[model samples]
Target: MSKLTMPYQCLKQCGNLLIAARGSTIETFNLESRSLVSSWKCPSSKPLVSETSAQEEVTAVESPAPAEAAPEESVIPPVKRRKLSLSETPAEENKNWKHNNKGKNHRQAAASTGLDSPAVIALAVTSNGHHVIAVTSEDKSIRVFENSYINLKHELKQLSQRTMPKRPCGLAITDDSSTIISADKFGDVFSLPLVFQETPIPSKNETPVPATTEADSVLFTPAANHLTVHSVRNRKALENQKRQAKPKPDSSGPEFEHKLLLGHVSMLTDVALHTYNGRHYIFTADRDEHIRISRGIPQAHIIEQFCLGHTDFVSRLCIPSTRPEILISGGGDDELLVWDWENGNLLSRADLKGHVEVVCHEHGKAATDGSVDGLKIAVNQIEWIMVGGEDLVVVGYEAVPALFVFQLTAANTLQHIQRIQLAGNVLSFIVNSEGVVVSVDTVHALFSSSEQRNMAEAVDVQPLSTFVFEDQRLVPGPAFEGAEQRHEVPAEELGRLGALLYGLENLRKREGDGRDED
Candidate 1:
């Protein structure tokens, strides 16, 4: 089992380093040594009110503007206006700050911007492993940082940050690392530019334009006489020409630096970007059991196709590094569906219902149920791993909370090869070329019960599990070993049982004969 001090919020393997988030802190560990290399905490953001300006801010809040009375002619009073949103409150209004304004008031904005705790919930590493992006809990923002996995000090430098309009459910970085696509709970996918250029400096001799004219000045002046003197027929043609020349307004607006890539009716669960046959395609999974394939860039709204075999909310998606054409997805369903997504064909379906049997120590064997909450067999997590020059799919189920490994056959089918029963429910996992690192729920009732009984003595505790497959068997780490199975058979001796039976029968016959004579 892997040793973890706190519950991990997210985990990603970058090169030989393992990056993980625990609450507001991010830690980097040397994968080879399995030791902590570095750790960084999310800096607590405070409001811009400094000690010098504290009195001014307090005075402004204390003496608020008087409420304006409604006109007597109106029957109902005007509805009260809501407070300004975090994005509306500017940070250093007179200064040209590099960061955005949404994180100005740390306390009030924290609720929307997640600047207070800034706990990372989702993480994605670039294909080159030089950069990483993380989504903060409740902030609706994506933060890009330099991947300093090898260094113990100066581990990360904030490169770019984009605030989303809604909480992000999933995040994916493009293969080229030029753009990042994030799926939000509001059923929208947006793209943010990773590269930036410095703002151009204005010429010193040029004067700044005034933002507004005097209040008494007229806003709109009539057109010149020569411009308005065209005949009705000619004017109609000119108006039509002007209308045709005008460009349509793009979804990319001035309010945000990011552009809306696409949208779905139901909330999205995950998104993945892949390059196939020299073309880029984006696969998005939603809560309504819909998986959509679309163009990755430049008019991403065009839907290419849909993979619609799932019956429940699709929560996870994976495309093997070796097999980019195949897509594996799992959701509330008991089985996993492997698809040739490019052709919209169901290559194979793997049902894990009857194949898995849980050995519960307290109950001997766990009972099965068909209900949603009572479901004993359900795929909770799926990952595509390339191990020992072979492509394998790592799956975790809630039934026994065990891990199962399946090797992709030459015919594009899954073959179960190994299984590992975990002590707790599997929450998340990260698989790399070396081995699989699984994060499980160690505080479950059954697992914690043992701890409660053995608390008096100091002992090492591991909240996560790590396993490696060797000879088609799962072997735990050096800290633990698999329990051996033993069965006892009833003992029996068969020396004179037949002779004893014959003697007993002879005695019964003699007793019958004596009774007849009497």
Candidate 2:
């Protein structure tokens, strides 16, 4: 039997350290030495139970056992049973009803735990490099970890964990590192504090009961009665309503301090926070092919402008630090879009499908899998980096084993430079002063066909690849010395990796006339 290796899903670089997430673990490596530094695994989904609480439960059960073992002093006399009225029920009956309701609630809570194990889907580092934020899939939680790189710690110290109501697809930290902005698939964006503080519980004496007014003290009666409801069906509904217990107000939202910034009618795919002219702005892209710009923080409700040109879902957004006014967006479209976001103008579109077709042909696969008309390109990432003293743009596509490079022209257009082919699909990458470190899926886990996946498994492939610029083109760089260590992945967990790593394809709309698109 062969051991299965886990593929990296996310990568982030902080100074001389590199953080990578694969499976449910986060590993940090020292880039200078090219050695693994530390690893931290996410906690389980089961709620934690304290030792004291468990002891108390055991004591309660044992205390009842003693009473059951007690000997009877004398023969107990049989008490006369009292007949109950037709309108009243026995106490045992009510107890059974409450027990049944409790069981139903317990089952519902268990069902929502989901089948997949917790896997880190997204990662972000604070600008100060003092903290790291990770988002997990199973619990939909945002976790904060203290970065203690100077001390050479063995594991990251988790400071806090706050679960969100919906799964967060994108995460960004403010420049000041005081707040975290998260965009979810439910079409809502929320901001949370970097360090969460638990709300203190107040004593019963601290809470004052409200005084009853004259109207509150009076008995309430409804105007609708049997006479008002003429039909038999209406009267039956009225009786059922009266017998049913009133529903309680929902309190399932997050209890921590969080504020809603802005929302869209379609699912949000990415979010970016930028500061231009001393004012913070938020740029968001959605599956409905809409790019929205809004004022940050208190003024987030104000809509600045919309950059709309693509006819397909927009999955990635990039705002170059060198060119803040230029926004690059890509998704299900065959071309990459260049936009002057502030003015809501589409500067130019670069052809990406042609390059993808060439790569697919070389790999012995058709660009179109017979499901779509033309070759569909899902851009996974768009990053700006300086290579050979020239500003360049690097783009990676989902399930494509290649990285496309282009130069941003003075006229605000993309000029093709070079293409760096790899052995497997590009999962994620981080660019630094040294070179580019890419996390590749050598196992072909993202591929849909079984034949392609089997062929990839037959050959041994490296999970991490490196590249450097030479003569304005990408060339192979020195291998990361100690960063090639692979972690073993169990067979059972392989089924869930598809949901964690391959999600952009789910945004594709089916052939129908329906308004809703999943």
Candidate 3:
């Protein structure tokens, strides 16, 4: 599915709780109790109404006071001021002004573009799950929240918010929680400080002026307002011009709060930081089927090597918690690739047909092996879970209405383990050691379409489901291959032999029937 069709959504797990982003709100659920702990509404971009109100406030504060009226006796008696009859009052004038500007059109456009209600598109949590960070589409801001895991509380406290110049699609927090790195729609990866610090003072004549707000930076001055109505159309036009006027990259250009670490020609979907053998590396996946591994921190731009085996847009990426050197990734392609990114070796790959049945490309259309296309089903999200002494990868899909689990076997292979059927397309999910929490399209989709529905009856709002697996299977006793079991075939092998014998019998029966006809 295209990004526009899919809402900005993500899932992150911490201890016994899961934090999920659904539209404009972030919700937390307790995996143990299978209950919702809390939900926090994310803030959207500042409203267009705020622009007019802010201008009015500025006028009230900055306008010059009217000259004191001359004393009646000192000034010649002006003609008795007759109250001038008017067709409209100030309120009516303002109402007509808004109507003439077609404010409704602007509001509708904002809604259609998802500007009015931006959602969280990316989220990350620390190992302890005590800290959370997310990127919102509307404001293009990164917000950090403190999770009360120790206190076992319902609410999360927001620590800080930093706005970005471009809308970010993915973000990664260092395991130490010291820095946050994000990939934006502009094909750029940037790093921002997680903790606030004081800005250093510039020497005399070196202090750079701060950037102005969006409205003030582009809108006309009072003297120039008469030239135009200053409606949303003009505002948009000015904004577009401002964006197009951005300077090309140069060494002496103004710096940003986020330092550019690297860039790509295609849109980046996911970013991750991995540490192996005391060395840190940054892994980035893009829409053009490219996954780059680079040296972390100060040498982030230094090229290491690209994991080059994907045939479609690489969307979801995860490093197994138990195996730090291994990387698992899947996108629109039918298969997921396992790689030793640290050593640049493609370890193994597995087809997803066992889990999801969907055409990878449109009928009669030749599939492009390494190009971005709209015809394929993509693995939307992935997370690692350890259960039953097995390292499992929980996979969620964009077009499929179910979740699949694959175990990373000790033999270094990806094996299908289980599938969890759901009511609607899986949007996002979080898998902790304890259980899993999933978010779907809607609660109504979970039930039969023919169910008699009451318009006002409250649906159970059951978008969140927690499934816990606490029973760790025990190890089996030793078995001798040459003993009594030597003569017996395993159930799996027996089934294969039975299928072969059945096919031979069918062949012999067909031959006998043909001889009789002859």
What TM-score, computed on C-alpha atoms, does each candidate reach?
A: 0.65, 0.75, 0.61
Whole-model Cα lDDT of every candidate shown, in order: 0.62, 0.78, 0.62
Model 1, which residues run further than 4 Å from truth?
Answer: 1-5, 45-116, 149-154, 196-256, 355-365, 368-373, 376-378, 398-400, 446-460, 478-518
lDDT of 1 by residue, 1-518 (tens): 32223345367888877777655667776676676666667766546655547655655666565588657896763444335444434656423432644334332222232224566768888878888788775555678888653544438667756666677868888878778888886688888877544344468998765344454233333233338657888766655554432232466533546788899977677898988988888899976788999997985989988999987778778898788888999876757889989778888888765445433433344435422234334455688876667788888654244678888877888888777776655556788665787765432323221121122221233544677667545688642121011111111211111121111111111222321100
lDDT of 2 by residue, 103-171 (tens): 232321221313225889899999998899999876789999987645645457798888898888899
lDDT of 3 by residue, 186-234 (tens): 5789888776643666889897775665644453323223246478787
RMSD of every prediction: 21.3, 12.0, 20.1
Q: Clashing residue pairs in candidate 2, if any?
A: none
Error of 2 at 432 (Å): 2.3
Query: How many residue pairs clash in all the candidates, one count each?
Result: 0, 0, 0
Ranking by TM-score: 2, 1, 3
Q: Best to worst by lDDT, what's the order?
A: 2, 1, 3
lDDT score for candidate 3 against the true structure: 0.62
